[model samples]
Target: MNITVFCSAYSLDDRYSVPAAEFARLLGSGGHTLVWGGSNAGLMGLLADEVKAAGGRLVGVLVELLAHKGYQGADELVMTADLAARKAELLARADAVVVLAGGLGTLDEVTEVVELRKHGLHDKPIVLLDTEGFYAGLRTQLERMEAEGFLPRPLAELVSFAGTPAEVFELLAAAS
Candidate 1:
């Protein structure tokens, strides 16, 4: 599977890094490809390193402004003119999407994908790894949206939340 992962570009605490690394190892050892932002910084860099070390293929989609920060060892790298194009390319390359703990940028990426799925623009499975309940607030908001009839489809059908690295793969496997 070509898994597109949206995550922090900033160096994170061990609490977040540990799970991200575990997820990377699984993606690599399982003979999958990682499709992500083409940055060799922070958590994004760590994920690429772990995945590459574990034998996974890396495909990076980078925006022009961040091209200088692109990973040196990606199996393939694509340069986009802007963030919107980058997101489009990322989704176009992914068989599924996995979101790890991140700040606003990561949130933006995941939100766009989810919205696309909700509009029937794509059917790819989207999973969020809720490490340390980092996504609890978002989950509550989404649940409220579901309860309020704001969404046309069931919340479960739109996205699934997993609590660990193993659970992320288990959900992906079942979805595939």
Candidate 2:
């Protein structure tokens, strides 16, 4: 599987980093590839490192503006003209999407993918690794959207939540 991961470009606390690393290890040892933002800055870099250490392939989709921060050892790197194009390419290359605890950029990536799935543009399975209940509020808001008919499809069908790295893979496997 070419698992596209959305995560922070800034350094994060162990509370977030530890689980993210575990997830990376799992992805690699499972003989999967990582498709992600091509940044060697923080959490993203850590994920690439762990995944590579565990023998996974890395494919990075990067925006031209952040080219200076690109990962040096990705198995393949793709450059996009802008953020929108970068997001598109990331989704284009992924078999599935996994979101880890991150900031605005990560949130934006996940939202666009879910919106696309809801619209039937794609049928990829989207999973959020809700480490430490990091996504509780987002889950609540999405449930409300489903309850209020704001979404065209059931929220659960568009996305699923997993509490651990193992659960993320299990959900992905089940979805496939």
Candidate 3:
């Protein structure tokens, strides 16, 4: 399985390394490939490093601007001129998406995946690693969209939520 992990650039820290490593270890143990933002910082960095350390094939997709931010870790790099292009490239090849706790950038990328599911552009599974209920408000707003009929129920269900990386990876493996 090839999984694309959607995550925030801001939340990268040593604190996040263990869970990231756990997720990578699980996937590596299962003989799956890991794909993610090619960043050297935050959760993105941790995931790529651990996945590679665990002997998994890791691919990094990064936008030009973000790459200049000095936060990328792709043994193999895909450089896009911009963020939108970066997402497009990832969407083209990733069979699944796991969203770790992140901020606006993370939200933006996840929104693209949601919209992609909405339009039937892809049936790829999306799992949200809630990480301490990081996505509580976001889920509420998505539910509100469902209530307003702005988003269909099935579309809203495109994203599964888990409080731990273990659960998120389980959902992702099932998706595969």
Query: What TM-scores do the predictions have?
Result: 0.99, 0.99, 0.87
lDDT of 3 by residue, 1-176 (tens): 78888876655554455666687777766676777778877777767767777777877887787766544445578888888888888878688888877778888999989888987889999888776667888888888787788875554357888877679777766766
After superposition, candidate 1 runs with Cα above 4 Å error = none
Clashes in predicted model 2: 0
| Candidate 1 lDDT over residue span 86-175, tens digit each | 999999999999999999999999999999999999999999999999999999999999999999999998999999999999999889
lDDT of each: 0.96, 0.96, 0.76
lDDT (0-100) at residue 109 of candidate 3?
90
Worst 10 residues of 3 by lDDT: 66-75
Q: lDDT by residue for model 2 over 16-70, one digit each (tens)?
A: 9999999999999999999999999999999999999999999999999999999
Clashing pairs in 1: none
| Model 2 pairs whose backbones collide | none
Pitting candidate 2 against candidate 3, the one with the higher TM-score is: 2
